[model samples]
Target: MRTTTRMLALFAVPALTVTGCGLFTDETTEKMTDVANSFADALNADDPAAAGAVTTDPPRAADTIGTLYEGLGKDAHFEVTGVDKDAGTFTLDATWKFGKDGHNEWKYTTTGKVDDTGDGWKVGWDAATVAPGLDAGPLTYSAVYPEASRVLASDGELMTQQVVTVVNVSPGADLAAVANLIGPISPGITAPSLQSDLTAVQGKPITAITLRETDIAPIETQLAALANVTLSPQTRLLTVEKELASPTLAGLAQLWQSDADAAAGWAVRAQTAQGTQRLAGRDPEPTTDIRTTLDLGWQRAAESALAPITQPATIVAIAPSTGNVVAMAQNSAADTQGPIALTGLYPPGSTFKTVTVSAALQAGTVTPDSIVACPGSANIEGRVIPNDNNFELGNVPLHTAFARSCNTTMGRLAVDLPPEALTDAAAQLGLGIDYVTPGLTTVTGSVPAADTPALRVEEGIGQGKVTASPFGMAMVAASLAHGSAPNPTLVAGQPGTPDRTPPALPATIADQVKTMMRETITDGTATQIRDIPGLLGKTGTAEFIDDTHAHGWFVGISGDLAFAVFVHDANSSGPAVEAAGRMLRAR
Candidate 1:
């Protein structure tokens, strides 16, 4: 009776579970879990086709999964959480990473069904299997970038986003009509030039030019009316004043765009019959404003000073007390030579006398009151050094010779100093030193060691092998005004990093140099426009190609401002001095 009862119990258990849980034996349960895991493995591998092959319907599943994966930034990942054989379902954890660096993530748990379907176990094919309510519509990922931040100067905004019209000419468009309509407002856009440009591009749509809103408003309608002409209004970072143009603006705009991109918000969404619904991602944060050390008033003054000059000219001004770049202005002629204001190298000429004198004083070669011979021309170690127009001062105080820009005296003084004296002094005054300044690429003047007396004489007079940019000369003047070289800066909060820290310029030495510069304005070569109050300057005439032609330079200090003016091929220091006067008076 016991054996018969046990046998009956086993049969009864199998009969009761046969239609439901009973059908899924250990083997069947393992197979189901295997199928689910295989599907997850394929998805994690980013192989949509392989993942779908394990599903009940391959083609439909592959296509749907591919679309969803791409829409989710193509960085999707999947994990099989659990498998419920009784319910013929499996749980999956889905994670999608977004953005250029995949720093953003959207994770969720989804459920899918698995069935034998009279063959082997396979995941049920459905868009819902990939995501909850995903069958509603197509999936998409998008980024909502915050508005570009404004570039602010010391006083106010220097650059802001504004609408600009882009003029595009399509294939077979009437080039003549486009040129005639655009040429008047846009410089350098003519019919023949447009034809040549279009032809070179294989008749593709040519983006002729981008015009500011004010410049394009009048002709917007006319341009749109022309066939194959597309006038697209786009947002661009532009200067507040239309006439305000500078190479610095381009760097500022790049920084602005980078800031905006970094603050961008991302969203994983779907377009459904009901409407667009966001699946994941956070709202974009507001972009921070970009602040520069530039002072708009000073910039305008510098620009105005160089406006009438046809030669390549620039003005670089710095706040001596803070080492902040207050203004940088370049004329159209200077613009053609690139950002020469900051990077172009030219012989600093007599401007370099400042360094020579400083080195002489530091080396104990001469005192400000010491009498020195300022011959019209002097031969030192086979090098002939001459003052401008061979001007001679038989014997005078060192300060008087400096004010007069007596090259002969400076040369003799330099020849008496150590080889590295001038190089060290120039570094102390910020030249001959590399500064990694933010928002500006600069080549400060280079003062190599004058290892020989001839070279020293040449360098003393700011001649051979000595080169400086306008920006560099400004720093030299700033060093004297501030009693030490300040760490130059462009963007606020970002001070420059010098490659090497030089010894500080002594206060006494700086004071003596400043005195000489003041005398230059009061009683020397720069006396022409010395009427401007509290001005201290040094005038320079640097020979380039030959003695007949030279670049003019003036490095000066006025109140708290220190500036350098450079005029390419100006023949003498007169133009630079004149420009400096105009800049100072305007301030």
Candidate 2:
């Protein structure tokens, strides 16, 4: 009887054990799922503390989670894609976005563990839970920039990437020693000025100067030996030729920065104890070069021609066939007054005779061969007009009068025309037209309508209300050469759009004006530069402030090239003509 009773008890023990095991497995599965759901919810909400609350090591987990989230940027998200309750783990889909507009995305799946360690079910804290294969270290998001592009000219690079050495002065350094060592090499940095700048920014290092590699090579060792001086090598965009400096470079740099930014790539990396680990992101795209219409040869020639002139001077050249600005150069004195070659307004003086002749030919008022009177001085409607130095060309053909720049003759013809005649003619020659050009800013010039004969006489001679930039005068020459006003351009593939398209000048009228311009170079005011072959030009000595001071101008066209030369306060047109000759000879 005792053996039979023991056997039954053993059988009952096996049945109870089976049922208890099933119940325990079900409860653990439910608890594990609950913990997984809580952890995913906390991460989705970007609540690091809440996420850590469902983990085993709360403090450590919270700190790491917070750091990783911040590093991934503001738009990181996590979701529990799947859960394996039997294995005590969950699958999480993680996504991070980066970039200025958050257009870049990084998506991946990671596995996180859940376990019951005698207390309760909790998520097991691990770096892998945040990002797959990540080590226990700070995560970082960084921008990977593309290689800087160059500003290209017609023949070669105008601006290129170069390494520059930055000279920095730390606080409490020997200011006088630094100044003495670097002052001569770097302009505008003196001992007193360094002290003032240092004091302004308390406890911060002052950058004494930035120098190109060639500029700093000889002085590098000397600067490095000094106390509190640091030489940091950094890459920068600078002109290929040191002498090639222009305000236009600033605009090109801005455009280069935009291109670099657009091609920039990004990465989410972990700064681990071993090394940097790139988790996600794409590599930067190759940067494309920026093309400009500048011709290196023309630029160099223009610069050299103006270098000797002590006074303010400039030269602007364009291609008649394309209207592309080939060269824009100014001397040091002219630079001080700003980009005057492109925007500063001065009376065109006798250069306006081109417009007058074109207007007369269009109006049938006079043919190129029509005889006209050109006295040294003439009174028309109570206003006195005279030629340069009051030189007379009495009763000559109209073409001869124009070639000689007979101001009285032009004035007489303008006084009989309609008020808007000069204005209309100026537009036809691209003088008064407004253009919206990319990568360049310019003002053509203005020709206000003259209602009275007195004003008309002045307007006809490029005086009174008429004003033109050197750039505008260049366009006038280009118009005569091209038979129509060409739209000006500075950057390749970017042409200026005129505010209003004027009617094209008649081919016959253009030819007539061209003939007169050639005569001006051969037998008229611009004969000083007559040796240049195929040259057609006009010279002017514009009186400003007083008769003793005048701005000299020479606008001309030779083959496909049209240019304007301006010599400020030259007192006569001789300097302008000489400079123009030098520039043309150089070409």
Candidate 3:
């Protein structure tokens, strides 16, 4: 869901909930950083032994980071970033500066130790990323059926989501032959020996590399050196970096130097913190930013902590001032072309009232205190649109009706307004159109394509053939919050400059809507949002064709970030409110 707002839409099957937070921390913050730096120094110094010397106890002998230094020396440089040091461990934040634009920068984190060995300070690579506890069994690629998945990232994290290369090893190539075959592929591993360090598959020693689970790709020729290496199949562990020494490692590196898979693997993992977990075999991860504007600590923590209680709710967060997507995650099991953000056409529910208000204001139809009757449901041009907030509540001010999400009020406002006014306002906001710019795409979330009174009434209430993407909703929030139309943007590197979006409505109208949205939490359906300190928000209860309990929705802005969320196909609006509260409560 963190891929794109729609990509993680959780429409039919609800709740792939995620959490948010600051940075990250652990036991070994600084020492890990030191070992990573020391390893970089040794690699620059062309001293594999010196690099191996700094490894901690459960040493990482043959993992990802370990192989980074296997064969090559003085070929790659390092760029260090923010580092955090904990109790006995440390995290080295750096990027592998290899080649000239051949690769931008491979980010990675190396975890190391400085446990008081009673000998000053000792540091080295952790064993998790390395998987040094090998069976001495040779590692090999399954050439008979070599397959790889590629992972692509729009955020430039260097991950792949496509196949790059394939290897067809001999039926039973020995470790030496395997090593020799891949010697020219990368600069990480060494050729195999005639001796017995490699494993045999069908008397062939075949193994496989899979980056499917994490959006990375796997290739045979790219991993020719590691083609036949096989640790116990039961072991489910992976690390962010390596601190190992092996001829096989050299072979993998050799392949990595030229071949795509090995090189990309090293590249993506290079800048991440060391992590170990079970990885499954499948198509490579989709090419998208794994390193979101999202705080890594929040993402990892959400996956770790929320896996227990939260289902899958599509979460889209952005920096309102700059429109940078901090995080996007969709927890649905799969895409069903259901009510996905950009595609599906569903009722926008009361959320669209802001648009209705805009239309009315633009047409000089209503002001904030314009008195409107709330008869629960109003028949606008022979079509009935009823209020879910059925408290009769006589006639009320325009702003009050919006904060309360009164369907009747908006429906009447829509019926009376010129259709062109409403449609124009929607178009100005970027709807009923293709929004394929660079970072985000607009899927015509059912903007009023034509002019029918029923449709118009529904449009006013965010219902009927009216739908929208979270990104679109967030834009509305940002527009209202800033009193200016701001295009949503992903934080690729930094906001060098931004394209200007003309105001979607008159400046005063946007300001008035902003007030109503703020009043929503203060005196409306979204009272739950008031729990947070400074908040402005709107809650929605969309009515689709097939289900009950209107799909809950809420969009809010705080600090410098603007976020929009939908607890699609849920049991009640409570979850959506909770999601909004989750964002609001965060300082």
Candidate 4:
């Protein structure tokens, strides 16, 4: 009887144990799921402290957790895969997304343990599980960039090389003392502003400015002694003539980055003393130099011509045959107003007579030999038009009128064409056309279509609704020189596009316009450059706000180069023509 009862008890025990296993499994699964969810919430929130709460060593876990997210600038989370109650462990997959677009991601499997510490079940966290294959050590992030390359000119001259210096300022013990120390080195340094900027943040340093190594060498030791100043010297590609080519050089750098993006010239990596891992992408290949269409000699000539100007001035040169930008220079005085040479909109004055003359010849309204009356001034439809200083040449040949930049004659010629003819002609010359390219910022001059006779008269003389930049006027000369509208290019492979293609002017018309321009040098307003051979040009004194202040302009072609010189508030065209002469002679 006792044996049978013992056997029956054993059978009953097996059934009870099987039933208990289901209950325990359900409870363990729920608890482990909750732990995984809590862990993911902390990581996604970038709350390192909260994430560390579930780990064995809170401080160590907190540091590693913070390092992983902060260094990479990423949002991380995890999804539970399975839980093994018998082994007291759980499996999960961690995911991290980086960058503004969130297109980059890192996903990996990791394991955590369920530990009981008096109150309830807890997760055992490890840094290695946060980022797959991470070892026990400090994690550091770095972006490795390839060595900066050179920028070369079309003629194979080096335009830029790798070298630069960075300057910084910080809050120090004595603001006035530091300012006094730096005042002689940086003439513009002010105590109040320096103090304010340095104290803007409690413990942060500020970058005051960047200068060439040669510029700062004289005061390098003195600056180093200052508690508030810091100097960091770096080697990066910079233009040889920093001021002359700064704007274009910056644009070229951007263009190079775009090309380098595909080749992976940069990498964001996570590294430890033990090993390094590429977090985002592979490293780049060795860098190569970039070639541009700039002519270094021409650029220097333009720079020298504008450097001594006390007032705002600009000079631009282009290769007429290829439409390549050979040189662009703006004096420091003009730089205060921004890149006005390329982007400033101003009346073209008589320099625009090129457009008017082109239209008149194209429409057969006038010939170079045709007789035109150039009075001192004339009233047309209630609007008055006059030559410079009201000068007059009565009944001269059209070529003579154009050579002298007779505004009255240009106005009279405008009356003969269709009201929109000047605008169309300017369009044909590449004005009013937007140039879209990488790193090139330009304002395509505007030529408003005239609906009234008075407006047409004003447009003819390059006033009223007609406006242009040195770049635009240079293109006008280039069109005549090249026989077609040249698409100006800076970078070798990147050429700018116009708004639309324009009809080609008749060869005879272009040739006649060129002849008239040559006359300006030999027998007209631009005789200042008459000694310079093979030069064709025009001079302009654009009246601004009642003629007390006038902008001087000169647009011309010398050899294979077409260019424009502009002097703000010059009151006469002599300065611009003189500048052109100096630059052309230098070239």
Candidate 5:
């Protein structure tokens, strides 16, 4: 409760009797009470260090204005106009001040953590609650805005996180964020995706998503934009109702057909993708409990922040804290684009060195001071690799090799760790497995072969079958950030019950890997961001998927968030390295 000066009357004005033991004055109380007030005096004098010496307890992130009150009440500036004692109690009357305009003016009710110091009054953890709203302040971190959130489901149970969408219902949330969140809520929105499946004429695709059967909630405004969006009846048919367009609505059928083409397209006859056990199409699946851990603000930020110059772009941000996906977007006129960055199994480009390097160090095969050549290209395993600067040169330290992103050097060292050890390391970081995440779009990069130690060398360098989603790679970067496995996401609520992922690699190992990443940023391929504070990452450009498109990737951390981005089938003709570098730096 709020123990304040005003509320003090309620506690003492004869209605209630004190319940604690009889008051005893101790020397400790007198000493502390004086100390608390002294700390307050220090704060008033703008001496933070002096105030800290007395009241060392940290304050809550939510105590907006109470910062004035440190160990005791450093900022508790209520005027002590006078002190009164009667019937074993003490009362003080005073006004407090805050702000240059002297905007804050109020009386405070308080209870002191008092002890009789062989002397008189002393202070304990005692304090009073100031009046509500009287201490008006800016909001701290809160999740209560009208933002869009994503939730995932399987077997009618949510599998991800409570990715609440705050702005989806409001005006101006990113279109990409709304679309991703739309992954779950269609049943209530009348299955606009299905309404979209009808064989009618054309215009822009109209679709809706909502909560289970009911009038549209304000959240469905965008879905409502599609005239075809509507909820299903008790049967949960999730039907698509079209006006049975005349030949007059020339383009309606084309629009209707577009949604039907999707794997998630609403179908009137078949009950398949959300499959069954006893039967094929007859099994029932409900859209109840679907959710995701997607954060609305970051999702919107990721979407609006990306702008591609005639080339396709993919971004995947996951909460390394839980593998909660924050954002996934394709910057293209994508009627048929796939989520390749997270699902496409392309060579890790140069970023694979982050993992390979870890494997090497864990094996005790390399130390920080070990030396290797700063070569442009080198041949091993009947294959050739070239460095970006193409200047195969003199011996350099292992740290320099990482900073330079030397493929030849990493390829040689990848063989240092047993192939199985390297593969296990990848799995520990949440790679080489079918994504436990929702959405049919998840693609597990091909796992490294256990039988071939020789192949592990390239795999260690993020080549071979080491393909990963941008999210997965981002996970790799985050793992380096935390020195452990990172769980990430882009949705809200439980997609299903959470499973304890195996813990990250040993902390010491994670630490070394992180140091290597930092060196890379300081003097390697990632050096483009060398001066940017708190940036640690790896850059890769590999010719793997097909001869036509060489993939370019950047994975790193800035502040608390981690990101994995890709330039798919990036036309090698342009400055892919420079472009990818610029984009990665922006993040």
Candidate 6:
């Protein structure tokens, strides 16, 4: 009986020992799993320092984890999975997003080991645990661009090309000499700025402005001869013709920047001693040509017509049927005023008589042939209004009065309508509304309330609180030709659709106004330009002040083309009329 009892006790000892070993193993695994889960929480929250606290090498772990985050373009996160505490190991899954959009995520798995510290469990730090193969080295981001696309005209003629010429100045170079050499080639190159750039480089060469290929040609020889200057050429987008430097083309050039940048591909890579490995992103898609509605021939002709005019002048030509702006040109004198053709705010002068006639006819105040009195001058609301040069043809038909630009007669006619009549008519003719089109900017003109007889008299003659851009006047002529206002467009695919639909001009009113404009060209204010076949126009000498010089203006329509020309500070409308004749003849 004593021997059997001793055997039972021996068996009980082995069972107790086995149970103790199992409990120790289970407790160790739970502690290791807790550490692994805490580290992963820190990494997921983008707190590498916190993650490092649970690692054997805290500082090294933090640095490695931080580098992995940055090397992945700062778009990375991790998860802890498949924890095996008995083996002191855990599987780490890392995700990296490198594209502009966060949709592209490169995911891979790595292994992290846990160790039993004196008091608690801690992770064994390794760069590979942050990202697979990151233990080798760091990563970098770069952009590789394809050949830029060219801008083309309606007839497939090349309008612009991408050209880059780097103007490099050596350290301590003579900036004044540099400016003198390059200033004539390009404006806005200042000596002080050039010197500042050179000084910032600290003996290294500094790149000056990147110019167009054609622009660089004239100064290439001079630049090469400079002792401390170097000219390096790279392809960049630019206008082909210097004359196309007008704002219309400049706007088009500005729009091409996005497409060019998109064609340049982006990549994040890891460059190690062994080789470079592409980590994320892809090459840019192939490019496509951008087509515009500009007619090069008409653009050149308009430029030629405005070339001879020394004063500030602008001309805009559009196809009345399609509302396609084919030509726009501004002389250097006008360019100083800044895109005046599309944005200049000036009184339409007698050109706005077109609106008056439309308003009168729409309101049933008069027909094209209704007889109206045209006196030398008339008093209305204590103000005197007269025709151009104060000469009047007395007692004429409404068409004759309009063609002659009889200010007093038109003033009388406008007084019969409500204050909103002229403004409402202007809106129907596509004025007073902004066009929200890509790459095209405009300041559509305005018409203020004519609450008093004095204001009405002035507004009738296009004098007081009424204004129109060259673009707006062209739309007026286009409205007459189209029997309604047509939405003008610059780009082929992106037509400028108005936010609110404009009311259509009545067909009868448009017809009568067209007749008045035709008669004006044939025998009235614009008779000087009547030689051009189908020419219909209105001449304007808008008085800016009581004693100062007036602005010259003309809005004309010939065949498919409708145009507006402006000459600032002209003593008479003759200059604008002559410009119109030259442009129409060229057309």
**Reference-based TM-score of each model:** 0.87, 0.78, 0.51, 0.91, 0.49, 0.81
How close to the true structure is residue 19 of candidate 3, measured as C-alpha lDDT?
A: 21
With a 3 Å backbone cut-off (N, CA, C), the pairs that clash in candidate 2 are none
Tens-digit lDDT string for candidate 5 (1-587) = 56697688876764444332223233333444465455445545656555444432224312422443331233235322222232322333434433234333344454333344454443322223222221232212111112111122211222222212222232232344444446554423322433343324234433333243333355456554633334332322121211111110112222222222221211112122444211111112222322444444554455444454455666666555555555555554321355455555667677777777776777787876798766777776666766665766568888888877777788778765665876777766656645453342455455566457557656766767677766567777766666665544333442312244554587777777777777767876665556677666777776764544577777776656667767766643133334434544454
Whole-model Cα lDDT of every candidate shown, in order: 0.89, 0.88, 0.52, 0.80, 0.50, 0.82
lDDT of 2 by residue, 94-177 (tens): 788888778888888888899987778889988788786555568788888888888999889999999999999998888888
Worst 10 residues of 1 by lDDT: 19-28
RMSD of each: 4.1, 6.0, 28.3, 3.0, 25.6, 4.7
**Cα error, candidate 3, residue 32 (Å):** 69
Question: In model 3, which runs have C-alpha deviations exceeding 4 angstroms?
Answer: 1-312, 332-345, 437-444, 491-504, 546-549
Poorest lDDT segment (10 consecutive residues) of candidate 6: 155-164
Model 5 regions lying over 4 Å from their true place:
1-292, 333-335, 438-441, 490-503, 545-548, 571-587
Number of backbone-clashing residue pairs for each candidate, in the order shown? 0, 0, 99, 0, 91, 3
lDDT digits (tens) for residues 65-163 of candidate 3? 345444222345543344445355454444443444533333445544455465534554454322222122211111011132221123333222232
Best by lDDT: 1
Which sequence of candidate numbers ranks them by lDDT, best first? 1, 2, 6, 4, 3, 5
Cα lDDT of model 6 by residue, 1-587, tens digit: 99999999999999999999999988887887789889888988888799999999999888877876776666677788788865679998878765457655568898999988785789888877777667777766666556667777786654556567888888756778778867877677879888777778776888877777766888788777878888887765666765565568767777776676667676767768989877666677677777877888888888888888899999988888888888888999999989999999998888999998888888887888899999989987788886666797889999998888899998898887798899889888887877876667987799887888788888888889999999888888888888877888887777787756667898888877878889989999888888998888888888887747799999988889999999998878899999888877875
lDDT of 4 at 396: 96
Candidate 1 lDDT by residue in tens digits, 264-288:
9988788899899887778889988
Least lDDT summed over 10 consecutive residues: which range in candidate 2? Answer: 130-139
- Candidate 5, run of 10 with poorest lDDT: 241-250
What lDDT does candidate 3 reach at residue 11?
51
Model 3: residue 408 alpha-carbon error in angstroms? 0.5
TM-score of predicted structure 1: 0.87
Score candidate 2 by TM-score against the native: 0.78
Comparing 4 with 5 on TM-score, the higher-scoring candidate is 4
Which candidate, 3 or 6, has the higher TM-score? 6
